[model samples]
Each structure stands twice: as C-alpha cells, then as structure tokens.
Target: MPKRDRSKRTDPTAVMVRIVVADDGTLTVSVDGAPYLPPEFSPPWRRASFPAIVDAISQQTGRTLRVDVIETDGRTITDFYTPRTPRKAEPQTSAAESSVQAASAAEPAPAPRLMQFAGSGMIPGEEVAVAIIIAHAESGPDGIARTLIDSRYLEHSPTGEAVLLGRISATVCVGQPQ
Candidate 1:
C-alpha cells in the first residue's frame, strides 16, 4: 500500500473570521475572504444570533480565533476573541432534589419572547445602534402590521465591558383587518 501524503492541509489555528453588520442589521459572514454560512442556517443572520454563531465557529475550529465586526459605516463596532473552551455548564442537581425543587417552584411558563442583542468584550461606553424587530396591531409602510424598533441606540456598560439593550414586549395582531 502506498503511504498517503499529508503536507497539503491548512492550519486551523490561523483561521480568521469577519462579520459585517449591514445598515439593516443583517449579518454577512466571511472566512478568509470567502463567504461562510453557519452549519444549517441560510444567509442574512440577524444581530440576535451573533453570539451563538461565533461560539459555534469557535468550538468547531478548536482554537482561539479572532472575530471582527464592522458596521456599514466602515467602523469596527466590536472585537471578539472566541476561545476554544467549552461553554460553562450549569451545575447538576440530583433527581430527587430537582423534583422537589420543581414541585415547590412550578409556575406557568411565559410566552416565548425575543430580547435585544447583547455583546461582551466591547469597549466600555461605546455607543451601538440596535435594530429590534417587533410586531404591531396597525399596518405600517411595510404592509403587514409591524412594530419595528429600528435606529435604537445602546451604550456599552460602563463597568462591565459589555453592551446590552432594554427589553421590549408587545402583542402583534397580523392579518387582522383594521
């Protein structure tokens, strides 16, 4: 049997990724100048899914990687250093204790809701523009009734090196005649 050649592989540790946030808050991901789509998702990722996307990439690469995010204005919004380390797991509880706790704290689960995009490892006090998708009861220019929270600004945490936006929740009645 002939021995296989092993000198043609690229180094995985040197991978670099760039994520561009368009003016509309949609994401365009590229790896070494080639477009890259996440494992199962299609293009046009939203801001809300940024962290998860990067985390998955980091885990797959198995090495600390650098991620740069830029806005349409050509300014670098945030710098992310995604480590190969696994996410911290929640502490396990014994089955009996868990059942007892569940019995004592059981309550009706709330409806699923979307939260604003959040990021860590950003410069303190930096201002970030956030686009929040929402639903509305009245029809707007987009035809269907929608409550879009576009052009919202959020300040990075002064003491936490993180960026967070306030919560927003509302009921949207779509396809209902006005």
Candidate 2:
C-alpha cells in the first residue's frame, strides 16, 4: 500500500487579512489578499469574515488572539497574521498592463453615473455608513460631492423610504465679475 502525503491533510493558517468598507455599510473580508469570493465550500477555498474566523481559531486554540484594526477615512479595518508564507511572484507583465487588466476585470461594463441620497434620523448601528459618506465628500474639494451606492445599501434603505431629497444652490464663474 502507498503511504499518503501527510502535508496535504492539514489546514493552513491565513497569512494576512484585508477588510474593505464600501461607501455603503457593506463590509467585505478577504483572506490572503485574495479576491472576494462568496461563502461557498465547493471551491475548497472561499472568502470569510476575519472576526468569525478568528473566533473559531480562538475556540480551537484555547487562547485569545489579538488583531489590530487600521482605519483609513474613519472606517474600522484590521488585518491578522497567518503562518503561511506567500510565494514569490515572477515578473511577466508591465505596471501599465497590470493596471489595465485590473481596471478591465473590475467591471464587465461601465454604467451611467447616478446620484442618490439616503439618511435615517435614528438607527441601531453606530451610523458608520452615514458618517463615512459625509467624511468622503468633506475630504475632497468643492464640486466633488458624489458617492457610488451599491445594491446592498439600496436594499436596506430604498429610494424614498428612509431617505430625503433636497438641493443646494451655488454659483461658479471663471473670471472676475464684470
């Protein structure tokens, strides 16, 4: 009888975790800096939330693991260390080419820009989504007050339900008034 490979039988620890907070309240967690994949088991590899996985590891290890949260633009984000070491990459494509590929892979097709607004006077959560939007716009210069809304946000707060519509007037001129 042939002996089985023992190395392949053990599950590996994650090396790094990347968390992204969209303009909306949707939080996405990726393992090993891999692209986000739906929570499924068929592929043998799937994306999972950092906190959930950490909790599981803690239970198994019988020790509490600490994670550091880094914030960029007022969002709570964190990364955890894993035992697995990443393999070195072979340079094949130029930076520009890689950028082009990333841009193309991001969206199959571009959609028209649409502006929508939503708000709630009282909510259970810390109102992270609302604060994120205002901070995003405020960080930029004038005339740049727009944010991309995802399907998840729309589903939670529909078009005209917990949202209100209003407009503000401003004037712009190239040169001094004559």
Candidate 3:
C-alpha cells in the first residue's frame, strides 16, 4: 500500500477572520488564524477587540452591520453579523399590542434587544458630515409627540415632517433647550 501525503490542502472557501462568543459571554476574535486577543486576557481586553475588528470588516465589506449573537448548548457563535438597514417607526401601536408584547416576555430564547442611538451636540473635534438614521418615538396620550436626539451630534431637526425612513416620521422641535 502507498503511504498518503502528509501535507494538508487548504480550503478555498474558508474565512480567515472569525468572531466567537463563548457560553460565558466571552468574546474572542481571531485574525488570519491568530488570536487577536489571547485567552488569558480579561473580559475587557476581549471586548476591546470588537471595535478594531468591526472597523476592519466595515472597511472591507463597505457596509454597516449589526452583530446578532447566538448562544447554543455550550458555545456562543456571533455568526449572524449581517448588513442591516435601520428600522423605521410605526405610526402607532395599540395599547393591546403593547400588552401582548409584555405577555410574551418569558422564553428560553428571547428576542434580541434592539437599541437606537442618536444625538446632536457640538464638539471641538474635526467637523465631518454624518448621515444619521433616527426612529421617532410614539406620542403620549397627551397628544404631544417628542423626539429624542443627542445634542452632541445635533446638526438640526428636519424643517418639516415626512417619512424619515420607511413609515417613521420626523418630529421637529424649534429652539431646543441647552
């Protein structure tokens, strides 16, 4: 019998970069088959790898991505990092619908928590034009609609109302307080 060749053949479709989230919520990043941060590092160090890798992937992919985390029996895989479009606000949500959402809170796997980040405030830093997506909050029973925007990033409110993105409307407030 002929002896088999010892050299390993490389898989062409393999992704050299990997993002792993362990069952203990430990996030690890490996680049080109090397640990971006070693296993002996603290959680903080592990987390610090996120931004750098994200920036690199963003540069390569040319897309804004949301990290969807998955936790299985003994391992957590951050395999759901997909390009995502920002969500638009619905015109209204009935009180009954809110109650239903509250009722469905119990489950082994809950829905991923969604977050909105926006702001408007001046800084001494470099001035760069930024395109921001915002979701308008629902109006209160008082019929007063309020929109929350960060003052740090505050360029200005929309001059008039229109669908900002999808069904979401933009609420403009005049002369915001300091």
Candidate 4:
C-alpha cells in the first residue's frame, strides 16, 4: 500500500462575490456564481447600501475575499477585501505639536485631466460599438475611485474610407496620501 503525504498545509480559498447595482439602488449578490441570501435577520439586503453589503461580507468571511461590483452605468469595479486590523493607540501629543504637524502636512495633489482618442478605418456611414475602460487600485485607506467607462456607437465618415473617431476625457488622481 502506498502511503500518502500527511503534512501538507492548505489554505482556504477566498470567496468570490459579485454584485450588480440597479438604477433604483437595488443590489443583487452572488457567491461563487450562486445566489446568496443572508439569514432572515438580514432581510432587505437587496436594497441595502453598497458599504453595508461590503461590511457584511467582510464580517461574514473573516478572511480575504474578492468582490466585483457592477454599476448601473455598465462599469464593473473590482476590489479585494481583508479583515481590518485593530487600530493602534496614538501617542500623547500636545495641542501645539498636533496643530504644527497638521499645518506641515502636504496637500494632496490635484488630479490630472487627460484625453484619449481612437480611430479605425471603416466603410462610410458604418456604425460600430466603442468602449473605453479605465481602472486603478491602491493599498490605502482612501481607496481609488470608481472606474471610468465610456461605451457608445461610432459612425464612419460619410464620404470615403475615412476613419471613425472617438474621444474620451478623464481625470486621473495619483500619489494620494495614505
């Protein structure tokens, strides 16, 4: 008889949660591609706020989890969540020292404005779908903003094989404070 290895360590897999937010603010949650319903005590979750749903899942999982939130405007936001660590006690400081520190701290830099353009050669008067997606992530308390997405129809120039053009404007914030 063959003996099996007995000392292997295996970690639990993180849960995959997906939520879709309707225009009316209703949220539908699915865990691992299956519908998830909290206990009766947690009814009305479909209408619960976004932060509330995140908190509930974080608490229930008690470990790192992945979440994908689909907004009403067709934007999909993805984020990872881990249980929060206990906060450390702040050292005692004089009012004067605290005020000085506050005054010396640098202001957050302003977000930069940017423009993106895309062109494709197509038959005259031909219409096609165009999508521009922007995403960002950060390991800070004040996390990144919701992703930007522009989806629309683009028509080719009415004359010759001229290119169809589309432009998307966005603001990107970088180097945010912790």
Q: Highest TM-score: which candidate?
A: 1
Write out the backbone clash pairs for model 1.
none
**Per-residue lDDT of model 1, residues 1-178, tens digit only:** 9988888765556557788876665678887678878556655676555666777777777655677777666866445464664579989999998999898788765554333233332222222223322321222222222222322211222331212231111222222111
State the lDDT of candidate 3 residue by residue for 50-70, as single tens digits. 545666655655444444323
Q: Candidate 4 — which residues are off by over 4 angstroms?
A: 1-12, 38-43, 46-48, 86-178
- Which portions of model 1 show Cα errors greater than 4 Å? 1-14, 38-43, 87-99, 105-178
Residue 136 in candidate 3, Cα distance off native in Å: 19
Q: Tell me the tens digit of each residue's lDDT in model 2 across 1-178.
A: 9988787554444334455544442455454455545457633221123335555544544432334333335545444444333479987999999999999898766553444443322211122222223322111222222334433434444332222211111111111101
Write one digit per residue (lDDT tens) for candidate 4, span 29-59: 8877988766678654443244556677778
lDDT of predicted model 3: 0.41
Better model by TM-score, 3 or 4?
Answer: 4
TM-score of each: 0.44, 0.24, 0.28, 0.39
When sorted by TM-score, best at the front, the candidate numbers are 1, 4, 3, 2
Location of the lowest summed lDDT over 10 successive residues in candidate 1: 169-178
